[model samples]
Target: MINHILDHRYELLEHIGGGGMADVYRAHDQLLDRYVAVKILHSQFSNDEEFIEKFRGEAQGAAKLSHPNIVNIYDVGKENNNHYIIMEYVAGQTLKDLIQSAGKLSVSESLRIALEIAEALEHAHANNLVHCDIKPHNILVTPTGRIKVTDFGIARAVTSSTMTYSGTIVGSVHYFSPEQAKGGAISAKSDIYSLGVVLYEMLTGQLPFTGETPISIALKHLQEEPVSVRKLNPTIPLIVEAIVLKAMEKDPNNRFANSTEMIRDIKRAESGLLHGDRQNNAISNQDPFATQILPRVSDSLPSRKSNLAPDEKIPQTNLLKSKKFLWGLVCILILGFFAGAFLSYGKFWSNAEVIVPDVVGKQMTIAKQMLETKNLRVNIAETYDADVPAGEVVSQYPAAGTTVKEQRLVTVYISKGGEALEMPDVHGLTKVAAETKLKNMGLKLGKVEEEYSNEAAGTVLNQTPRSGTKITKGSAVDLVISKGPKSRKVTLPDFSGSTLNSIETQLKSLNLKAGTVTEVTSSKPAGTILDQTPAAGTDIAEGSSVDFSIAKTEKATDKNTNKNSGKDASKDTNKDTAKNSKPADAPKDTK
Candidate 1:
């Protein structure tokens, strides 16, 4: 597929990397004069229109995402039999390659990379998109140490293959969240869990879950706790380790509610403000032996009455009257004893316990009243939320139904509508960079308009909701990008002494095709290519035709005639010799 151009825009240059069902190629976008990475689906699935449309739809959703750390999608189209996606090409190795080469990175370096990835994830989650697959191979590390998280919505279309060599999918199983492994409901928390696995790998230079088979690894993701990062690498900070563990909690409810929460905790980890005891995933660190074991009562109910020997019974008395008199004296004694016991015990029995009520999503005032009436102090923490409306509680700590003593602090997060973000400066930046900027700010991409400018093509010239404009989450921003200076000419490549197949490849690469064929007389053997209309290495407009010819060898009749003449001459000589020597042989064929 090399040298093939799709949609007359992206020219396939070289194969880069890919998975079982796709191939990634480094290509040049002729219209924009920029290099792009083209990902084309495998032909095996081309006939399956349903799968193709699914992939296309996912690509469309991915195209809508824009974040500094995400590889920007430029276009998606189909040309002939090839269905492809054009993306911003970064000139760097994947995080997978880096980790493989370095074996392990320092704690600070790993944290920096992890934070960048988290920020990208936060933007995606805010847009209601989840990356089902998260691994080092999809994370690009640029020369400037910037992280670019790629393959956003495409992972949803990537079905798991049973083949073992499909390292692409199998390798990702190591980082799969428990729900993902079980094929359960996937959400933002799932991504956070995968990111936590990535963090663990970064800190320890090893996968948290691994096995000889993908199924085994998946099972580990579902049922096993990962080895501690700090235990593997002591240099990792306590808070950083805790953040990683907290995010990897197997239970979705136990994990971060969303990427926003994870990012918040990550930011605090950078300052070492998180405590070791706060790790939700630290349930793995707990020593089961240290837990107090309460003796469990047998499932058998207590016997209602003990077996009695009937023959031993003798006399029956006024048991009720005698018991009443004894109970009266005991009651008097208990009252006097309680009076003395209360005087000695200060306030052990004074505090009452109440079951915490579920107040999340309720109006802040109503929730406050509910908690106050329950004798629990309401501690309100205001924060922005896209899903929860303003004045409503977004979430609560020590979630409802937990029994706690009176006057206990119950923290509630009140929503303040969507978070306000300023439009970032994107002028002079590439279209991909601008899109990433918008996405990272929790904004969507609007119509992309192009204009001719002196600046290089693909560079952003203008943007709407102009830079620094404060906007709520999920807002749309339009962009005007340069189409590059008009260039009607293209450089022709050398095609000397090449076969028809090679010439055809060259023609496709140069966006030109053979127009006419003619016979040419030359010293070369027949069928050997001879010449072309326009000489190689000349500049011409794309689609301008170049004619070529093949050599014609000598006529076959002439060779046959020469051979017949020689044969006749030899036959005549043979006949004359036979006649001359007939007398010596005594007998010759008279006929």
Candidate 2:
């Protein structure tokens, strides 16, 4: 289907990839003049009206999600037997390809990619959309290390029907969640489980579970625990492994509550890794895979059996009456009281105090060094800031200048830079729609220039910085609006002495049409122009038709020729009769 245009808008360029239910093609959107990926449903699924409707509905729902890490669905449509979805064309290898080529990724790289995927899933889940299938194959990795999760709604739509159709499951069996394997209720946690499998594969370069057949692999997902990621790849961090296991829990309840929680844990793990802290390692040391047995309790306590019961009972009463024992106890209590007082004074009241430094607006490293110089401990927290540069402190605890004891923990907030996102494609959208979309995305409309074009009036024809460009929030976007097609006037060219065919061709070249061709008897060659309406050199609007009168060479009348032939026949008959009569008389005498 190369070169085929869908809905007269998307031109199929090349076949890129395919799966069980659809074939993806790289296509060019003619209206917007931009590249897009088109996924056409397989014939088997397209013929099913129910599946088609569900697929369309799910795709539409997924299209509502606008995230940098998620492939955007631009349009959904059907042409004849082909049901297709136009999506953002991401240019890069799949995560599966990257893993295969690199064997396994480093712990830091794996966590980075996994975090991006989780954040994308968090956005999808927030919209109540679950990407039932989350595998390396569906994750696209750009050259710049950006991750984009694709096929958001397709998995949900596929799972809505029997997965055993055509003896195949819609998603990869190795990555299936236990609930999905058992045909149970699917939720956001299902995606978390799949993401865990993806992360596991990314870290280990192998699927967590595999078998000779899809059924065996799916059974493994349902009934077995995957080997520890660290066991497969010793370089993987313990906390990263813990995350994978938690997300892949057999019971959905045991998995992350939602993608947001998973994202938070991933971020925490990443932060710990960056700071070289053992906090996450200590937390992850409690292996989730280990079995725990509760302590047993006794119903009743056994009675005590003492060998010197009588002597021991007598000592308790005698001890209270002994004057020597009382004097010894009084001396010991006075010594203990003095020691406690000395320890309390040294621990809390005698420590030196230092004023917390003003670290706001300072670099994180510099601030930490300054705080540490005063025997103070530094704690870091990061947040996005549009005005402040990254790695700089935005705020600090205790108002930045409070007096506190030595070794006090000071929390400083660092800027992570301005919030950036991929600019959305707005070409062909009406003015109101474009404005509303920009406003919703925290962007502002800059300048709107009007230009005459074939597009409808007020439609966006061009935009500055273009789509897919990385832009910060609140950035201004300029647009060029269409003013509709231009109405142009054309000067009628001289058609005098020109053949009718030439005149017609010239009219067509000028965007004019031949209105009527009238034939008239004239002393000129046939098909030659004799006269023309609205004579030559007259100005006319484009697309106006020009009428023409052409020369016609008339044929001589047939009646005169028929009369001449009849007279010749009559003369020949008279001559033959006279000759025959004379010859009859002479021939009779000779005989």
Instruction: Report, for every candidate in turn, its global Cα lDDT versus the true structure.
Output: 0.77, 0.82
Q: Candidate 1: which pairs clash? A: 66-439, 67-436
TM accuracy, model 1: 0.46
- Model 2 TM-score (2 dp): 0.48
lDDT of 2 by residue, 1-591 (tens): 999989989999999999888899999999999999999988988777777788889999999999999999998988888888999999999999999999998888888999999999989988989898888889999888899999989989888764423222457788878877655678989989999998898888989898644545765786678999989888776667778989999988888888887887787778767876455454445644322222345534444544556556533458777898999999999978866654422223546988889988876556766887887777666666767876578899866678877766788887766678789999999999999999999889999999999999999999987999988777889999999998799888778688976666677789988878899988888888877777788988898888889898666676678889999999999999887867544545455
Which stretches in model 2 have alpha-carbon errors above 4 Å?
A: 163-169, 278-591
After superposition, candidate 1 runs with Cα above 4 Å error: 159-171, 273-591
lDDT of 1 by residue, 17-124 (tens): 999668999999898898999989888868877667777887888898999999999888888888888899999999989988999987778878888998999888
* Native-to-model Cα distance after best TM-score fit, residue 45 in candidate 1, in Å: 2.6
Flag clash pairs in model 2.
Answer: none
